[model samples]
Target: MLLLGLFSHLLSSGKFWTTRRTNASQHIDIRFVFVIFFLLKWSHAQGSHPPRIVEHPIDTTVPRHEPATLNCKAEGSPTPTIQWFKDGVPLKILPGSHRITLPAGGLFFLKNDEPSASLKIFSADKDGLELEVKGAAPTVLRDEFRLEPQNTRIAQGDTALLECAAPRGIPEPAVSWKKGGQKLDLDSTKRIRIVDGGNLAIQDARQSDEGQYQCIAKNPVGVRESVLATLKVHVKPFIIRGPHDQTVLEGSSVTFPCRVGGDPMPDVLWLRTASGGNMPLDRVSVLEDRSLRLERVTIADEGEYSCEADNVVGAISAMGTLTVFAPPKFIQRPISKSIELGADTSFECRASGNPRPTLFWTIKNNRTIVFPGAPPLDRFQSINTEEGHSILTLTNFQRTDRDLVVVCNAMNEVATITARAQLTLDSQEDRPPPIIIAGPVNQTLPVKSLATLQCKAIGLPNPTISWYRDGIPVHPNAKVNITAAGDLIISDLDRKEDQGLYTCVASSRTGKSTWSGYLRIEVPTNPNIKFYRAPEQTKCPNAPGQPTILNASANALTIV
Candidate 1:
């Protein structure tokens, strides 16, 4: 009871207390507490307090030749004594070392001459309770690079990251970047910045950003420059010059110019726009200059064409139109034929052209025959067949229609062509006198009015026909012509030369027939029709209608 009372009195007076020490020196304090516990043979009481730390030594860093300090402080009853240790060994101020213990339970180094060291603090009172604090040594740097940026590639308008790191140093190295030997200014642009332990990041990378890059680390110890790295910025594909519209003749060659620009060279292809089909490998080729070439183009090859360019970045296309033309060509031609009296005969002509073709017929004199107009004597007709074909038919063949010629003309924007054919009478054993079957009559027509006269004749053997106007041999022209059946037609009749006598003659080896007609042109007045003024005759007019035989044979005759 007396011993317990004495322990209580000591605890109440705060003479008995416990102290805490750093992990490194904790065992020293624990043994001291055990020795006190065994000597007193008593337990601690609530009236006294355990040694509690008010300040603890913390981790520290300093220059190689500079002084350093680690702060530590504690409080307890009966004032604790502070002690220092290193690596579980009691620390003491050696003769040559600058390390020493501080009065405030801290550690201090007058000069940091060693590479690295750690210090721990212990504080205890006479009762053997303890407390602790610990501190770390200064840090040092390394000599070699740990990581470096590497070559990289990225497309434009995308993010790019380049990693870099420097070796540890007394004063940490400063990381920077260089492009094409020029220093990168991170503060000047928001698109570029440093991150993730000295890694370079570029947002919305552009073509100008492509170049050799390097990572630089600088310190008092040394300077480090990473290996040169390449940064490639790719651009989307685009067309500079595209194909153009073209018009060419069939069987000719054509070319389409295609020029493109990109980071990497783009590939070009020619495609048919309508069908989206690939170009024909046999006739179409891509040139070294990136132009498209087509050899021996045809009508079927005409259409919308497109040239497409593509690369790893993107694709582009351009379009143009192609036109092909063909000249007129004859598919079927007129052929000469022989027909019997009163028999019908026809001539056919067919042609082909790119724009189709128009057809027309011409008579023996090469005078174009007006279409859809009734033949003077209802003995001739012209018919249009298919797109580019025509036919000329003769009805009720007569002797005067012998030795007739006809031609078929096909025309288009490209060219014009004609096919010619002749008609002859079949052989007949009996020969008879030529007689007139139809005769022309006199008529007075208005000026500029069309006039036509018919004169038909027949004989055992067909007869040759001829015409004369006002004592002169009638010449067929654009305004006048003689039909195969011995007829005459006058268009846009003028009073000056067309108002005169017209005569028709049919002749054969046996005999001859004749007919005459007068076309008097009159100008219509308000009240009465007046005859067109005629030139006065100096002397008697020659008999132009008189027939003169140019050539004669046993079965035929040609007259002028």
Candidate 2:
């Protein structure tokens, strides 16, 4: 089909030239005819067709300094020579030229300027065809900015948006953003991103995100930057160093340190939570360093306090407790008294302090005798009552105790104090010494059995009896019981722990007596036990067999 079309086109061209031919033109026409005959014979011999364009170059847009192509394909017997022309003039498309012709009659626009015009294509002895080729419009970007980002202010943890766009250009300008004169890497962080039309979006804005932002647009022709925009991030109040619980002495000064930070400097406030009011300005004041200072703090000022920091964004608070300690002071003193010999007398003492002082009694006449640690004297009893109150009683006073003095002491972590009272007797009475009538004797008991030791004493005044093992006091518990008659009883006695020397003590104000005895534990021995020696053998005749038990109990077992 291509061969027929080429032959027809050649005949038409010959006819056209003949109608307008002169003598010289006719001569050239005859040569043209011979060339056509030779082309037809070559086409038949090589089994080839005349040049025919299959695809033609179409209209297209190309950016400046960017590569592009205009395609044109043709077929022929001798591979027809393809030529390109613009505006009906042949185009000089050379090697290394910006506008160069392809091997198949296509035009290639290298990285350079492109022009829009009508393109013409022609093959050997073939009619020419025209197609429109166009370059990109607005190839050079304008100097003025198209869109600019404005100053943005947002709260922390909120999304921030900054919009930017480039001016019209042949090759659209690339848009980017920079912070504080440094290019922002959108791929390095997940919080910042470039969105629609090169707009910048920052999620979860933080304090570090506050800076000057600028948008940049660049193309082959030129580059432009938007006006610098400042980003302000509002942060809530945060406490860096808050108040802490502390203890201070009364009448002393103390300071509670507080430090806070925020975008809009937060205000600090000190409050007493116990009284549900602000700190009394009379003695307490807030220093320039944001610390609460209290001068000469008293017990009444000891309570829970709060340090509050507030800003436009939010508010926060911290609590601390102040503990004030005071030294011991006596509120009541014991009065001196005189009593008949052998008659009981009592003295009462009381004191007060910030920490509820401890009250105890001591005899100050001859030597210091601390109550609860005094020797066994039933006649002299010292009782501690409710809340800093104590009572000291002297019963059956003897002649040698006439000029004795009783002392009451109060103490706490802060300080200690003492008060003394003199006791005078009208007349002295003689008292008999303490004597042990019945005492514990040495005895042996079996394991897991019960045992009891007896101790009885007599004196002018009833004596107090106490039991001990190897000088260690024995207190009553579930397994050990001390009866009113001074008898020590032990149940479920252990073989190893319950064997020791026991002592009994009987004491009174005048004198004292003691009796000691040893306790032994008996353990039952196995009945079926015997001692034997086995002869040492150098070699064994047979291997030992597995043993089997015939009888078994908790204590012993038999195996064969």
Candidate 3:
């Protein structure tokens, strides 16, 4: 087939020259054309030999980057058009790609290019492959030392791997590493090592690991130096001297010192992290000389201060506690409050000091806490500072509370202050009967479950609650418990026995009143049966040795 292509090309060229005559005098000589055509037919009759490969390509293991050549010469009547293939695929020939085939069928593989595995030779005329590509030889390509990862940054406690390679050397080069003019010890501990494939590795990089690194490749041919690479180990900021706690008197000067060290020099900031939010550093007195200073330190200036340092790599913070000694001083003391009977009122006071002063309300009789038996709603409640006020509430003022003097006590480690406020009340009307305030509403519940009938009443002179079941006094037992708030809890209730009208009677020295609610306990009943059907497999028995096949139709699974 290759010979036939060459024969056809020769015939075509001969016809073109004769048909387009350069001179009019030159005419087509029919005899010459006949002779040329005859010669071609005679040659075809003689039978030309198909292209046969004399030199074959073989497998080679060259250096990673080295020039290569694959010879594919053939012996035939006419020269063959050689096409190269790798891994069963035709190679696309490009002139500037450093990998190309010449007119004579010589193939070139430039440096830094990988020649394929399983080199195959084919005739462009599709005459089938005839080359014997016996696979062998390690052909390494040529390249000077080149190190990967020119520069890198990794945090401490991580591994660093840097590889340096020397390609195409006659003898494999010995690789050595250096950092900061000191020879790197590739020891047996494997911490700092030169591993397989000329890799320099370090385990758990530290501050000492930060340095410019170089890889040297040496052989009898020459010594090569790789481009300098840097191993930057990111280190978090650490306070070397600071986070010192100081306790100073008010109107004293104080300073917080902080020292930190890391690579790339980090930024520093002082912050006061509070539950409310971060207080901007500018809001407080500070000095930027690696320290924070407070000239006239007061309670407001006392807090846990932070020194934070950060860089592109990481960040860290150190806290220093500042304590300013200040005696308790009332910022605002509770004033005397006058209100009508049965009115709700609040008594408030606030003080500022370091070591935070505890504020409390003390009655004239030295009672700092309201009686435990007092209704939860009518008790003296402490207001949280989140509301911007420190207060104690006096709910439902009565005649007995009139003229009662109460003291607001604020104390800290330094000192204590007491401010008194006398309650002045107008003449009050007679105490009214208890009025039901919440719950004890009618309800239906499942049997064997727990239930609470909350009965809350509000009145003057404090009320005492009593419960009755079916008009009779009810006593608390294991399954029936009455809370201090007069709410009744029935546990493991019976369906029929626990269903009844329940009453709550509240009474005080002033008067008595009653309220009622009803409970219906429901026990669950079994679901009624509708219909049942035997499965088809049980109703229609299959013959022995025969399988019961299920229907595959869409309606086979319809539910009733």
TM-score of each: 0.44, 0.43, 0.37
Say which prediction, candidate 1 or candidate 3, comes out ahead on lDDT: 1
lDDT of 3 by residue, 37-115 (tens): 1111223335666556676654433343566665556665545555554444556877578776755566666763453
In order, candidate lDDTs are 0.69, 0.71, 0.63
* Model 3 segments more than 4 A misplaced: 1-141, 145-158, 168-190, 204-213, 216-224, 230-236, 244-254, 263-266, 275-289, 295-304, 311-314, 321-409, 420-560
Highest-scoring model, TM-score: 1
**Candidate 1 segments whose C-alpha is farther than 4 A from its true place:** 1-56, 59-205, 211-231, 271-286, 295-305, 340-344, 364-366, 369-388, 392-403, 424-560
Query: Looking at model 1, which ten-residue stretch has the lowest summed lDDT?
Result: 25-34
Better of 2 and 3 by lDDT: 2
Residue-level error in angstroms, candidate 1, position 45: 22
Ranking by TM-score: 1, 2, 3
Candidate with better lDDT, 1 vs 2? 2
Q: Compared with the true structure, what per-residue lDDT tens digits does model 1 show for residues 310-392? A: 87767889998988778878899998776777899989888887777788787865365835334633467887854556778
Candidate with top lDDT is 2
State the TM-score for model 3.
Answer: 0.37
